[model samples]
Target: MGAVIRYTTDGSDPTESSIRYTGTVSVSAATTLKAKAFKSGWTPSQTATAAYTMSISDTILFSPASGEYHSEQDVVLSCAVPDAIIRYTADGTEPVESSSPYTKPVHISETATLKAKAFKSGWSPSQTATSAYTMSISDTILFSPASGEYYSEQNVSLSCNTVGVTIRYTTDGKTEPTINSMTYTAPIAVSETTLIKAKAFRSGWNSGTVAEGNYKLRLPDCITFSPEPGTHFSNQKVVLSCSIPGTKLYYTLDKSEPDKKSIPYTEAISVSETALIRAKAFRKGWSPSPAAIGSYEMAIPQDCIRFMPAPGTYTEAPTVEVSCECGIPDVVIRYIINDSGSEDTLYSSPILLSESATVKARAFKEGWTFSNISQGTYMLKVKEPVILPGSNTSVTQQEVQISSETPGSAIYYTTDGSEPAENASLYDKPFSVSQTSIVKAKAFKIGWETSGAVSEKYTIKAAKPVFSLESGIYTGLRTVAVSCETPGAKIHYTTDGSIPSKASPCYDSETLVSLSKTTTLSAKAFKENCEPSEETEAVYRLKITTPQISSDAGGFSCETAEIRMLCEFPDAEIFYTTDGKMPTESSSVYDEPFLATGYVTVIAVAYKPGWEPSDAAVKHIAVKGDINGDCSADMSDVIAGLQILTGTDSAPIRSDYDYSEADLNGDGRVGSAEIVYLLMAISKK
Candidate 1:
């Protein structure tokens, strides 16, 4: 048996609105049940049950944990209790089962809070669950000590605008820094121009955008030149540049100082003559550096010209021509025809050489040195007739008398078939020829052409002897070679510096000429039926040793140089020049080393009476603002200057420096202003 149950639908207790217990009590609608057991009433089971309300389910849990997110996400509500309706709201309001039943997942696309709840017919309202879906956007990074120039040294710091993000950077701005780059842990030292790049990175989130910051902190660098100073070249352009890239360079060419407002250097400037170019650098934020001076020295070379027909003696008239070569387009050729006349005539055409004349030509251009002289001489046929003795004629008499009909004529004869020059022996008196011989004669007269040479045979003759080596100085031991024009003629030579005779050492083998003091050698020829040949001589002057040049180990100053020259040979002469020219025998001989007085190159050579000139020794010296004579003006010099000013112990004084090296203003004395100048020179303008 089962007990019956009764219940009331009103809100009342069991006495007011009673419900009896039955086999089972199920409520499909809103009702309150107060039950008690009856019929068997056994002292009324103490109201076997008091009240029955309703059953409720738990609230739902949303998937995808609540957090700030960057992308879109789905909002799903779930409940552990079965057969419960879950509802969600994206408008950040309270959620109910009937508001919007979450049959499917709710899409959350923007930044909003999702509120969810669960409900059933026999259950109370479930707990509300809310999830906030905030769309996270990466923030742009920030840089401190922003991109600009810094006068002095500075430190640069990097920061991320977004919280909880790290920044990475690198000194090499040319590359992009990734997460593997140097992690920025401390501030960077910006002593020079630098570029800093950084980016923000975080796990489970997109990396922040890359940011860059450039900081320039440096002194104005030195300016540069294309063709450096101390250049004496020509026909070129010069380019001015600065050590700092992209810096504006201004220059002046009119021998004036340069400033920022002067002509800006674009490309290169053409230098035609000597110019003192002064230049300076200019930038927006940097200080104007000291002027960099570049003075260009150039020399225009003269044109080269020459005679068309080489200068030589001619027997007949010929065409005289002049040719010239010059690099400049505007050029002219000036010429003249006299032997001792100015070349003032401009060359127009070729001239005919009808008589003996001298032609001198030279090329010239405006603002250029005149070219080297070009000279040539032309000679015509002689007017005199042939000599009385014809060529290859036979003379029977033992002595033949030859004469020229021309006025003031004189005859010279050679025993061998050789031409008679003006220096040949004069035949003033006729002599007897005891043996057969060959005679060659010529007639010469003042202000008249020479007669034709005549050669006659008197059955036999001998040729003259010729020396292989010319009559000049010879160093060391020399082997003299001698030969005659005729094959069988015996060659004779003398080493005692006297005229040779037929009895002198006959040419049978080699002859060696040793050097002692100045030694002269003479040689001649002799044959059976011919007169003795003319004597040939050579002077031998053997050398002892080369000359030596010496100076102070510290070398010379900018204004003066004292050098000494000495030769091992006692009689050797030393020649020197301070202009860098080679010292020839004709150059100025030095008695003692002298002051150079300016920036110059010193070259010296030594020559003995018969020995060759010694190899030239050269040295070059110059200076800038080297006040302490230490080859450079630097901070050490500044310290020295301060010591000199303060009268420190063991310090060099101002008078110790030379007038040219220490005198800042060329006032012939060293002063505090000079020390100041030296201090300014420390930076090397």
Candidate 2:
């Protein structure tokens, strides 16, 4: 279209000095080309310009292009634009902006599909790039006889899914297998506990996961026992066991080693008394475990027998009892009395011992030995008779009584001083005795020996003599009569204070006792075949009457007063004293009336021979005009005398005039005589 054309390889406007365009401009890459048309003629037409850009393919590029791979691959995705972002999805899903952005290469280990896309800001997104990948890794290595426990040696083999794959292995659990590790050729021998690991390798395939296994091969465990090996009471149930499963246990009751022929332990075994037990364990295809020995000894407790009311003497018949300690069940207690060879009797109750005997007992059971013999010796005797109102005593008309401590026993007694025999009189009732006697008694029973003789002496004393008069003061003589209750009792008397005997005076029915003086009369009674009665006595006072005083006791107003003393007993002498002293036999004798001049106290006593003295009689005298009894005549007494004469103060004067103190003339009343005596007394003063 133009005569000549010029173009620029860069993105500049074309000029004349630019490269001239030839036929069909070819650019190795994208470029902006320009051309200018020119000729010698007038103005050239507008320059032509064109931009040349290479087209980028939307399909992704891959290195080592996707195909089958024996090993894992790292796949990369890219865009032609340097600043384009590449997002990828390896799970065969359509890629989006939210997919994982590709920064480094993506690793592929298994069969998978990878898709990718490129995006830029304000630019159209590139089409999804897709690729398919396949992986060929060695199949998991296999092991024969998977990990477990075994009792004996085992042959372990290693294999893989790929036929004839080269497999490297390691027996130690710590080291992992590599191609340089041990090579697997045949089966591996495993004796003790071990762990086996292996890995498979080929020229192009990758190695599989490390194959691992553990094998335990050893001997079976030994047998054991419950309640192992010791002495026990009663019985024991021996249980045998082994630690390993499906193992057989054998045991023997006797003290011998156990073998396959011994008793197989299926249930608990019973061991009674003293015995030993041994056990062992066994299994097939393995050596027998070590022997387990259990020595069990059984002991039985001893049963003891005892006797109640142990070996001792008893006063009366005793009941004996026999028993066993803690009382053995279903055991028989046998006993024999007095003789060892006698027939045995089963004891159910206490044994009655009426006589002396030796009791022997033993305990018997079915499976146990007889207990030791328990013997007791008992000597029995009758109790002696008791005599009522016991021995060596005196009594009057006694009735004797006898008894025995042993019931239902006959008692024999004798009145003489001899021992009682079985044929003597048997005491039936109380017997009366008026004379002294000695009682001897013994008790007798059927099977028991007679009791020892008991002697008691009873002195039957005669009744004491009694007097008709009692002992007291007497004014006249008395005749005493003595009497005795016994038939032939004799009475004796003594006037003196000595013990009365037969040599003393004998008393009759009538006897005179002198009462002129005080006397003590004693008497005693006696009889044949009886003891003498105790002495009895009577005392007679024969006291005289007390003397009488004829004068009044209060004040005497006269210058002199006449006092008289008299007694009822005509022969008694009355003695007196004027000074208020007690009158004895040596005092002044009272012959007639006496005179007292001043204040005087007359005390008198009457006495006679063989008689007790009489009590004293007293009289007091004072001056006639001394009305107040002051032992003198004065004006104060005169005024009292004048008061007694006048009737105006008669009440108070009469109270003070008791005992006729103001009766001066002894007329029993106060009058002009008392006033005249007081005036004469004042004149005399």
Candidate 3:
């Protein structure tokens, strides 16, 4: 017979010495349990073989922890228990067995809360698991061609990592970009230099930071050579220039390409020998121009017969003199106008050239070969136009007039810096110039060549000076400061109500002007190259001393209390009001002593024509000896006043009445004098 049973959780056979089997055997995982029945010395029964398996419910686990995310999320749900089914809800609701089963990863492109649970066929459902995700757009905007300098026009494109993001942009540098700005859909055409600011926005994501891209598009103009490269019989002066203002020119004389490291051309180049010149132009915020090649061929100088007054333009009729420079004796000089044959006139005196012509001349000696031919091209251009008021001058306004020395010459003008064309505005009469401007005028005639343009610049008035203090009433000594917004301006000021001029006192910015008495300040701003600014005036009225009341605020005993007012300034007029109203200029003037009766409040103020009014002075007067509240001075009131002073009274008096009636002399105290005054007031009553 079996008395006890021994068991082993391992798969080995159970022996007599194996552990005794308890009420229950705990198995964390699948195990084979063997048990045998045994008694004191009896042989152990055959081991009973049994396999056990365990299954424990586990909570659902999310692939990623709950937190904020910048992009879309692919969430995965799992469970520790094998073959357990996981269910989840994305709408912040509890997950049940009837909810959508978790088969694939859940897609979370926006902010949402996901709750899930794990369940099996024969196991209890795990605790509810919760996860929340907050999504936002963190991708920065990208601009094509980046933010850099460009020589030509650019087509800019905008992009973001997000697919459905909208980009707003602004070309103006003042306004910050918002969702309501210009939407970037297609490539933007940037023809000029500008600053582009942009921001990205999405439906359910936060807006991105502003991105700035600065694009510079400037193409420098090519260089131009004066007198054109050609063959000449005299030394030629080659000048390298550019159409754009403030552009620097670099050139090489050995027919090589020119760059920034080449020699800069500042003046005209004297080309005596045959050489090739190449030049390029450079300027800030602009691309370098292409190389300009000019080849100049030089020849011998034609100096045999020289023409006087040079071969240049002149407004008046010039007397051209032709002289022979041959070493031989008895040489003759002959000249001809425009392609005329050799049978021309012989030179005797200077010839007057009233029109444009090319003079060809030669020297001849009877025994020697004929001298080389000399040619001089004279242009006799039209007279230059004259501008009134001159150049580099300043005025408030000017009437601009243009005139030419030659009659019947038409004048063309332009305010901009461009050269005047034949179809430009014709200047027939004087025009009014009220603002700063640059005027260019040119004269043209049908017979003669057009004259060179005359340029003039005029500046308008300077900015008005600003005063730190406004025109109002002030007190005590005040320090005033003046300023001018126009740079390099000088400020002049006056304090005697007079207009300021150059001769007035100049105000230094580092120092402050002081004023002790009432003053009317005037200021003006002036500069060397600008007209003086308009006069600015400010009236500073000093305050007058407050009036003083002659009678004290205590009681006074008489038929009527005499009240007087005084001021420190003798010229100040004192005004008073007895109806408890504020005193003004229209109040009664205290020229002499005034009398007041009954209970009254006297307010007085002092005023002057060009000064601020003084603070009001107040005085309160009560009916004297009226301790019994009868509004009169009598024997019974005198007894009440004596009782108040002696500290033995049957009826207590009102504090306001007691204070006023006790002190009859208005000395701010009550004593024997009050008693005597009260007795005298009773006699008068």
Candidate 4:
């Protein structure tokens, strides 16, 4: 750059009409400046060019790094400069000054190139930035036995295309998780028309796309009984048939586990007593055929069924017997374990169950009605006691730990001064506590009374209050919120810079902090039976001030006048009004000289924000004569008005008063009527 460079504003070759380079040349919009170096009649140098652009918005920056994305994205476009307007377009094109301004955030619904720019007055337009967003699916799901009708209850398995992703499936047709819809880990049982929707999830990545299908299961191959499965006459020979082929049928006489060792069906046995028949088939490499059941009452007298030992919790399997009318000869008993209904085991002798079970049985004999069904529920014994860290009352301790002395016990806790529950928020790790917290814990085993609720108390110290807004300079009215980490702490605050106490304006539920004038807000947090937090403060300074002009602005007689404006605040802008409306920040800014033609009133105000606005400065100027613009009216002007009225002079009335303050009537012309009106007005004065 040269010190004596001549620049052309009209985009032409630089000549004597070019301006001498002094400091910086500001433009309200985009411009190209062509300059040539020249010194004392020396040969002019080659043309140098510079371009500038001033827009309403600044350049934009995006979050979450741009890439091919499969799902909706809340793309936030932001600029570094305050008060800068942002504009954007998804369609690639040059943006103008009046483009769409950035509001909250840009939502990219599909693949597109997002172009944005920032603009503000007095600054060169920023370079445009672009982010290309493309739709993508991180993973797809594959459902085995994909949605459709089936002959029976079907086992369904689902898999995700991508590794390291967790799949969640929903059978309730709702997007949110429920008791029935759960995270997928193994095969699921489907017995009805279920719309199974699944989505894949991985940390730090957008949730994968959702895939859904419907499934239905029906049972058609049920067992067929030759003699209907109801009350039957003693000595009735009933035949059982299975619909599935190549199936090995098995049956049980004593209510016990039926395996290959159980009795095999070679011939139909004559029924002398009541018998409840249950059977199932098995084939290699296939799920065991569906178990079939039938109940038949023989036409004979029988007694109620009974268990040998009482039904209660036991350390080991109990040798339980299904006994019925002991003197009845050749009576048969049948029972089902755990209500599984999987098999009708014949209870011919004492049976020992290894696990918990609810057993139901009946006895039948030839020519006898079936005995009344009897049921019993037995539970295994409690394993051991859980010994977890229990009571604590330290001011610094934030959490209490829990563990089980027995390997299989689970711990539960509560903190809201309420009784602990097994389904409360799980205390898997240490949690922060800032106030008096009553924590109750309990250990649970499969068969044990949960260890007496282990009660604990944590006495916490006071924590400092945090402000939603940091202390800084603001332009307008602002609202701030106060928050305490302590659960039950009360916030007290002041605006006069006084130390806050219990008597100060206490914030019980209110969180809003409204600020209009420059102030320092101080606050403290207090809680009963606990500590009070340290006093903290924040300062907010107001920045807008009223504007001032060069003069007090009263009546003035002149052909034309120019006014200058000023403000005390840094970077404050001045706006003015000719027509009497309140001056706002959006009013016309004081940038260039204004021509006051004829009689006029000028009102101006100063504004920024965060500061008090300055009072309006009004200036009034009046020009009475001098139509020729020599600053005075005499015989020549009288001659001109008459000449024009008499058709002697062809000059228009507007030529003298268009840009000069000479028209006394405030009209747009200096014609005969205006001249007569001016003479009469001045005569009265």
**Which one wins on lDDT?**
3
Which is the leading candidate under TM-score?
2
Model 3: residues with Cα > 4 Å off, grouped in runs? 1-59, 220-685
lDDT of each residue in 1-685, candidate 2, tens digit only: 4456777777777666777666888665567776776655646657677766554356677765888776668987767776677899988899888899889989876678889988765456778888888776547777788888776678998888664468899988889999899999999999667899898876544456788989876445566777777755446777877777768888787768888999988898776655577777777656667667777754222445666677776667788888777344667788899885869899999998878788887877665445668788877778878988776545466788999988878999998868888889999999866678898899988767788889888887877888878988876455666777767888988876678888887776655544456878888987777888888899877777888987643443446668888897868899999887999989999989888766677899998887888888987675555565565556766666666556446432323223354566888776777777777766765
Clashes of 2: 8
lDDT of 3 by residue, 1-685 (tens): 4489999887888887888976888765568989999888777688788887555456677877798877788998888787788888999999889999999999988888999988676456778999999877778889898988776678999888876788999999778898789999899888778898989888777677888889986545457778798765456888887876767889998877888899999899988767798898887766778788888865333467888989977776678999876454677888898885657789899888777888988887553456678988888788889998786544456788899998778999987657998988899899977656788999988657899889888777778888899987786458889998777778999999999999999999788878666889999998774688989999888888888886543443434667877788757899989887998889899888877766677899888876778888987676655665555656766677678668885844654443554566667766667667778866765
lDDT of 1 by residue, 422-491 (tens): 8886877655554465677787765345768777666434455666666666544456567776556777
The TM-score of predicted model 2 comes to 0.35
TM-score, prediction 4: 0.24
lDDT of 2: 0.75
Q: Each prediction's Cα lDDT score?
A: 0.66, 0.75, 0.79, 0.68
Better of 3 and 4 by lDDT: 3
Per-residue lDDT for 370-466 in model 4, tens only? 6767788877543332223344444354645556554566767777667667787665666666566777766666644455665666656567888
In candidate 2, list every pair of residues with a backbone clash: 516-610, 517-610, 556-623, 556-624, 557-623, 557-624, 557-625, 558-624
* Pairs in steric clash, model 1: 4-21, 4-22, 5-20, 5-21, 5-22, 6-19, 6-20, 7-19, 56-123
Candidate 2: regions farther than 4 A off: 1-303, 306-333, 340-354, 365-368, 376-395, 403-408, 413-426, 435-442, 449-464, 476-479, 484-516, 522-537, 543-607, 612-685
